[model samples]
Target: MSRASPRYDRRVRLYDTYTRGLVELPPPPGPIGMYFCGPTVYQRIHVGNAIPFVLPLWLKRWLELDGYQTKLVINITDINDKIYDAAPGASAKLSTDATAWYIEDTGLLGLGRPDVEPTAVETVPDQIRTISALVDAGHAYESDGDVYYRVGSFPEYGRLSGQNPDQVEEQEPNARKEDPRDFALWKANKPTEDTWWDSPWGRGRPGWHIECSVMAEKHLGPEFEIHGGGLDLVFPHHENELAQSRALGHGFAHIWTHNGLLRFGGEKMSKSVGNVVSLREALDRWGREALLVFFLSGHWRKPLDYTDETMAAARAQWTDFVASVYDPSEERPARGWEALAEALEDDFNTPEALAILHEWRAAGQLELMKRGLSVFGLEIERVEPPAEVNVFKEARDAARAERNFEAADDNRARIEEHGWTVRDRPDGSVLVPKP
Candidate 1:
């Protein structure tokens, strides 16, 4: 491709945590493959867990809108210490149930799904083969039946996290480790842990980090355009994946894009602090558009607070967008969705894009506004008010024509009571269904 090609000139640029810079995305006609690290299904996911789910789905839609063929892969880690600890005897069943809940909950967000949602349990053979290759290459070691990655073998161990190799602290401390900083590739099964897989190391499950590496490779292959997750994964979870995959000579992801965590009451939402809000509860409270708009209110790389006040504001924003369709069309110079697209192209800045959406709405660029909202799955379908609403609307219209302002006001209140409002367009008064 020439440097003057649209691929080069209009390519999406995103912040890569690995490079610690805003980097140009590889231009496409060629498929852009993205791998997002998904939840470890020990329990039903929280609102914090849903950020990774929403960000990539939105990115994929935007890329497709820009003429790129995209494949998005989100992996589920069903085999992890969390699962074992959460459900001792029924770890497998718990993970299975939680995975189902995760799919059902995230599906409620109304965004289109990923191309692939591979589970760790389903890819054990692929993981073992990769781990064995790592062992053969002297990138890993076995001690007392457990397998661990030799961190020193990969000299660029802390490059992604920006910590010196010598300064990186031990992630998993076991006396049998060759080095204190080395992390588990395969953990030997415990007496209480019922979920075990047969591997070269022994009967044990793949470690948390290796599960993602294998699942990502199995679906998207050894090389891809982007690997994404929440900001919290930057250190050990993602760094380990980068080190292990690179050690095996796989090219892996070119860019690492992480979304900010969802915080509640000024702290990261945690079960320990008793502020954890389930995704289901959030969806139930705020509905799909408001919850999504809340996410859009903040840049993908910055923290967002989850409070009633914030959600209420998001709901109001969504109400404004929905109501715009009923108002008279103010045909201004067309934006063609380019202004919002420009915001997205410059590092996927969702908050700025959202502001542009508001501008489009205010400028009466309804068509452009709708086109932009669809990219983020914030669809606004204009529905007619019910028959009962029409009675009041007609009465209100007649009263206004007869110069009975008091009766017209009464009819307006009655219509609003039924969750419908009247917007007097240039054509006529239109009854719009309320949010």
Candidate 2:
């Protein structure tokens, strides 16, 4: 863990060959057990579903800045189908305490918290002891009270979505499923929705792809290291969670990645396409550092596109990189902040690490643009302004001394649209904006 700490660089090969469609798969050789596919809270999580919570919190903070040693888990399905269609009351203590209160409302959505969440109704007895050891090794089946999985008993079942469990069993089944490429792992207790209990396949629940193949084999085991989410769940939810962790013989994730999909004008962003928004209303109208510069402005596999002019150009490029790092202007130009630590050590090439942070803030170099905004999480800091902008510039100088020029031009355009700048003079006194 100390190879001269650049966090121990040189790793990043990355995968997602469009979800291993060709089956290459190889990445986790040392400490990297990730697993994301979380959240099914039936409501309020949007920011394009927190783009699978910031691409596994930027692949667990860029694989702990490359030194690895990550664990990462993020489960929480809370018994599927959008929490049984928004909780149609049933228990495992009400879908595992309502999906741990919708994943603590997504750890208050700034995306840095989750290390282990685990739900699917507290891993339904490890998904009924992993579908009773894949139905006593025949790779699963039950039928009426439901259990399934047999997509013709593995055989590299469509090798992660290249698709052909005999063409997904010639496509058509899905009534309660049996074999249109058999899926569910448990589900029987239907007196009319949600249910639970030590299942043999009776008091139902636990089937959305064996709750992340038994919570990634009970917390990142049976091989791990990267299995990210949302390139529209890479074909049939990570190819049926890689056929339920290779029908329980282990080895399901070894670099899968998947980000790309938060579009708006160019379409996509669905809540059945209402063009959904809500990362708690874009953090109550743009705040968590302009929602992490609108989720690091693209290339976590690509397709960005959201708008109100791309979140007012990512809140005017995070207010001109925090007013060019609080522009005190001592004229310190030399910046080459180790070329953004050599472009975030390549592979996390955030637009070439924001073009080495606009060539270190166009060379005025505010300490190499605050160490390239602290390795691209966008370092922030300089915000001040809210004394309510000097109480709206002393009520915009008592509304231009009561002549009330339209209430002093609406508190001088709301303190110059909250970034501030106002001056009125002619002895009326207003002046503010001088960060």
Candidate 3:
């Protein structure tokens, strides 16, 4: 695709976790393929989980705006130990219901759905094939009924997470494994479990790490543009995926992007930790624009704390922006939009982009402000005041002109009762909806 903006004209640099630095993405011959690690459908996804989900939407929108067709794949992890534990006798039913709820909740954020959403249950055959290839290549082994990836066999195992292989702790300790750090490619089905799939080894389910690897390969092919998830997945999950895919002789993902975790009270918000805030609850308390503005206030790569003060501040910021909307026909400078685009081009620097937006709004560049806000997926609707509101406003204006200060104040209070705010200007007053 042709580059539509100078911001994406082969000059933008995105940070890759593999390289540990900013690297330029080569112009793709076709659509850019992006794979994001999605939810494990054991329960409702919290706000922290939405960061990875929403960040990719921003990237996809920016890329498409710059004339690049993007294919985004987000996998639903339906087969996992957590799902079984959460539902006990009805794991499959739980996953199916949770997956549907996930779609509904994220849709509330107003970001469009991904191009492809493959489930682990549907892609079991592909996963079994990948595991078989790994075993044949001697990168994995089958013990009893479980298949484990031999960590020692992959020489470059620690490059992605920068952990010394010898020093890395074993995630799932199994006495039957050759090495302590060896991870499962497939787990043997337990007699107590209800969900099971037929594989070469036995009736079992795919591991968490292997699910993403197989799903990405099946949908986006072996090579893709970007692989993204939360920073928490960097160590064990992504590190294992890197080893397993590369050992199978495929260039998995060119750029590995990770968003910082959302925190509450200076600690990572986790359901297990009993500190999670549901995405629905947050969106209900605060509007979608305010929630998005809160996310945009900080850098995507930096951890952001969610607190009442921070949320209130974001609400105020959004209200202020909405209040500033004026005549779209008014002429404004274009420099602000250019500055915002430049910031976004630099590894999606949202904080810098937001600062430029504020500067434009303060400078009375309402048209430019509206355009800039739209680029970040914000829209400012121009609402017309009701006739009764105009009547009160005109009464206030007349009272002030006649030097009736008490009457003017009373009329202003009456307008406020109608859920409108009066912003006095040198020439006249502007009526804005109450924030």
Best by lDDT: 1
Tell me the number of clashing residue pairs for each predicted model.
0, 1, 0
Which regions of candidate 1 fall more than 4 Å away from where they truly are? Answer: 1-8, 400-406, 423-429
Query: Cα RMSDs of all predictions?
Result: 2.1, 15.7, 2.2
Models 1 onward score TM values of 0.95, 0.38, 0.94
Put down candidate 2 lDDT per residue, 1-435, tens digits, no spaces: 536645234345555543543232233335777788877755656777676776677656755654556778877676666655665674345555655555665566545676787777667787788788888888777878877777776777776557656776343256766567677777777665746675766677767877787788788788776787777776777877788777777876766777788888899888786778867677778766666667776767788887788888878777766665544334645645555545544545566766566666766667667765664355656556678877877887887678788887888788888877665445544343343
Candidate 1 matches the true fold with a TM-score of 0.95
When sorted by TM-score, best at the front, the candidate numbers are 1, 3, 2
lDDT of each: 0.89, 0.68, 0.86
Question: Model 1 residue 399 lDDT?
Answer: 97
Q: Whose TM-score is higher: candidate 1's or candidate 2's? A: 1
Off by over 4 Å in 3: 1-10, 28-30, 327-336
Model 2 — which ten-residue stretch has the worst lDDT? 20-29
Tens digits of lDDT, candidate 1, 1-435: 433544347778999988899888776654789999999998889998999999999999988877788999999988888888899899889988999999999999999789999999889998899889999999999988799999999999998888999999788787989899999999888899997888777788888899899888888889989999988898899999999999988999999998888889799898898899999999998899999999999998898999999999999999899888887357676565667878899999899998988888988888878888988998888787789899999999999999999999999999999999898866779877777
User: In candidate 1, residue 159 scores what lDDT?
Assistant: 89
